[model samples]
Target: MAGGSFALPKPRPSGPPYFSRNQVANVLHQVAVLLELQGANVFRVRSYQNASRLLGSLSEDLGELVASGEIFNMKGIGKGLGSALTQAITEGRWPDDWIDLHTNTPPGLIEMLGIPGLGPKRIKLMADELGVDSVASLKEAALNNQIAPMKGFGAKSQQRMLDGIELLSRFRARRRLDIGLRYGEAFQRKIAAIDGVHRATLAGSARRRKDTIGDLDVVVAVDEADHETVANAILNLSGIADVKGAGDSKISLILDTTIFDESFTVGHIDPNVLDAIGGDDYEQLEAGGTIDAQVRLVPPHVEPFTLAYFTGSKEHNIAVRQRAIDRGLRLNEFGLIPETKAGDLKGMEAAVHSLGAADEAAIYAHLGLAYVPPELREDMGEVLAAETGSLPSLIETSHIKGSLHNHTTLSDGEASLELMADTARKMGWNWLGIADHSPTLKIANGASAEDLLEQGRTIQQYNAEWAEQGVDFRLFHGVESDILEGGKLDHPDDVLAELDYVVASVHAMTKWRGRDEHDNTEELLKVIDHPATTVLGHPTGRILQGREGYEVDLYAVLEHMAEHNEEGRLKAIELNASPYRLDLDWRLCKHAKGLGVPVAINPDAHSIRGLSDIAYGVMTARKGWIEPNDTLNALSGADLAKRLVR
Candidate 1:
């Protein structure tokens, strides 16, 4: 009452304005709380909290205000808060207060919050009470009999914590594409065995072509009446850890535990248990035992495949769907269906097809479209080409005539060259190339020029012996040579010129600091254009987590190779099937195919077990829409030799 002239603080902006500002301010306040909880400076913490509240009350987006230079007019927004908001919007970074708060928080704790039972309070309690700060420390303490003895932790709680840690570890180190497919296939098999489940297929990320998946999603189609029973049957499966959520038609559960647990436990569970838990859990739970569940179920007639079909990339599906629509027809997860006389088919494949379409081809023909290959389903203009009857013939496993790019004990490989050759022959390959590393890579026992010549003589003698025995397979001398800095091949040009084939690779240059500046793409293009270089080995020198390799512009390299046909424009890229580094990433394979560049789907096999990796490569190639004609290995040994020679 000093002057009795208090302005009542501008009456704090009425209605939604105050509410909206308060909400935003509340979020910012939460950030302050998090920072304070992490022990940030009290004064700085208050500033963020105050700013958050002030910004939330504003009617317009903070970014828009900042852009229009109207932020200064907003109450409580001074130069400091304004600058912070601008930084957050433009750089996708937190304010200085946030950065300071985060700096004090233990690393990986943010990710640890994702675990089912852990929360901020509990995490803080663990940190304060038991000196547990990291996932590794928590795991160590749990295993060492420290956590269960803590104030609120019980034996069951400790076990759950251990399970959570194990799950997190497995989830962190998951293998990509194949893991999803295998889990989906296994789940499909289980669902198929159930009596009332007329059809079952995997959907979601597995369908979308994501390399690694967090969960497996299977959608089953049954008779409308049988949905509840089928759902119950799935929930009752042996290895189910918990029924996360369920409805009359849909049920979500976590499957078996991690591989570490699987190997130790009886009746080892499927490795994809984490993926079975999904975002639909809460929805399914809320739906409960109502007809609303029926909304999620695919109809019996085409549900199984349709569920699988729809679970993939929506972008990919849209492309496929648009293709169907353009042809005066409709397509869905079920199958291609004719358009209704009334214009659209209500997304029902059976009803639309029953109106008198003969087959898949016939359905496409009716739409004035040519048959589209399943492998080339990734929209990428394939549908347009198919309509014009210009779709490329993608490579198939059968198109591969010979196995090349194998290693032996002469390097870091497990088997002898002869053993690898015998296995290649047994696999029905017409030829096999031994492309062990060169001398500089000490870890692999890479051969010197003299050693390579001796190895060549041994291979020649082995081929001579096999030829005398009338064996159909021929052995070609090759080397997986390291591409050194300055675009130097591992061996001198003369030695490389002597080999039947040269798989030029960036092994040591994987960690070269000047990757972008050194022009790895141009360097690679130069190698591919080299007269002696036959195949570009693992175009991306990646090793999973170990390194990402040079950011060589693959599209540019592919385009360059496409343009330089006279100097052997038909450069072959390796589909290195080392599970960790599925190099020449499948995404790039499509670009290569589009440019008419050749690919070599090599297992890059180091042993008999490694040879099986070809299946993985085949699937990867299929995903990229690579056809047999685009791969050099699809050629017969004589034809392949002829091409390599030139």
Candidate 2:
């Protein structure tokens, strides 16, 4: 559709692209669920579930696979499911004969499965007994005592159903930060390219780089007269699935996205695309997720005003407004102006005399404050810091010297060690730390001691060869040693001591599973006290939307490390750069820095391409006011070695 386009002759698609790999998988999954609800054959239902997962884990594009006639030979694809995937991709639905089956159940009934104590049998009972078809109806029945009188339904079960609804409601409200940005930026760019648009910038928590975002706010500037043109331009964008409203000044819409064209190209392979297909931390950009989007257009003079106003933590804006009031001025989305009584002024936009409003820095200057970065706009003493000229120079991506928590093909990573090292070298770094997982975490195919020693020899040879070539890049070997439930390390101290650094982490049984938060806290304390443990990997063991962090007193853990840092034990906490798991979240980074604890903005990358996530980590660290001095990886290899305990 751009420079050139060629149609693939075989596997002719009957329609334009509609379903992404995720959508195809979801359709199969939904079919399986609906069949089970209706009591279909167990084996038949299980087959659909298996195919859904197989598709979810695929690297190849489903449409292209069908187009290439490769679906028939693919593993885990039986004839029934193969036909269904291709049908869903091209036709956007299952076969005509199956339409009734797909639509037989009310869509909301599937959501009931998410409630912890509810299953198909319970749901079927509820449907039959209460005539419930949606969460709303189910809630009504529970509240009305309709289900409590039925068999196997009592006060506790009704209470659980109510609790599950509350939890799902919260999760439904906002998206994790990276997820929103991944989808928002694409439309932001597309809208800014429209004819009447002069500029486009994402505001709200996205611009401020918060850990999670409620919605994306985009503000643009255009000629005063081009407002409608820009608004309609936003309405027509491909992924703008639903328009909530539209106006001259602003428009609200729902954005549903799959992997954008910029992120995925079927049948096209590149050497640099680690995690190119499916690996940890990699998914379709948006993965066909949905988020709320707001687009607004303003006059050039009011561009900075609206941007700052919209890109605010409510409290941050309140602080700025109060400061303006004290100085005989007022601020709003329109612009900054002389103080006006309600009766004397039409609005903030109608001011006759203006202080400057063309840029955020100018607005801050007029208010007698330094330009605050979006990351620091949390109103967390930033206003006073701005007043006293004591604001910090937040760390940037360039400040990171090299990453310390990286993975390779040796353990659940997409790229091989050679590939990962080559990528690190290309980034102009002096060294790269490779910390594969321990053997006990067999799900990642963790490395044994023999494998570690063999990898060490391979690294030494590569270093020797690269040295002769004058590349000057060195490799450091280590393991992401698992911290078991009891706080003991998966590897022996001897094995840990053989490496450059041991990144101790809790990968499984992290939740407050029948144990006190104090138990988890003490567990981490013991692990951190291990002489061989150098950094804590994802101190929280959180996977963003998928899993909450384990229960533990993180503050106590950070305090413990602060006291131990001088001893060269547990030198840093990982700012895991994986979009899904930016653990040791930026909010806590500042506290760690204050405690004299260092951090490593490690990509926790599974492949070379995944290394780019370091940029996100750097931004997150900035949000916590972390500086170069607060990061261990900001050091040269030699200095880093000196900083570590022998």
RMSD (Å) per prediction: 14.0, 19.1
Candidate 2, residue 22: CA error in Å?
32
In candidate 2 the C-alpha lDDT for residue 231 amounts to 77
Summarize candidate 2's per-residue lDDT along 1-646 as a digit string, tens digits.
0001111112213343345555566656766777887778888888888777667645465668887768878867868777866776666656653566655777667777755468777888889778988889999999998888899889988987887676444333456666678767887888888998889999999999977777789999999788877777677778765565688788877676632545432221212222322344334433544577888788777889899999997668988999998998778888788765433675543554566666899999998899999999877788999989988899888777788988888888889998888888788778899998889888778899889878888887887887799876788778888888667887777767777788887766534444556677888999888788888988876665455555566778889998897655556888887766777776578788889898888888887878878888988999888888889877887787666545
Q: Native-vs-model 1 lDDT?
A: 0.63
Give the per-residue lDDT of model 1 (tens digit) for 224-343: 777777777776665454444577545655554221122321111111111122223422321221110112455565553355354545444676567667766566655565665525
C-alpha TM-score for every candidate: 0.66, 0.71
Those runs of model 2 whose alpha carbons end farther than 4 Å from true positions after fitting are: 1-172, 262-288, 340-343, 510-512, 568-570
Scored by CA lDDT, what does every candidate get? 0.63, 0.75
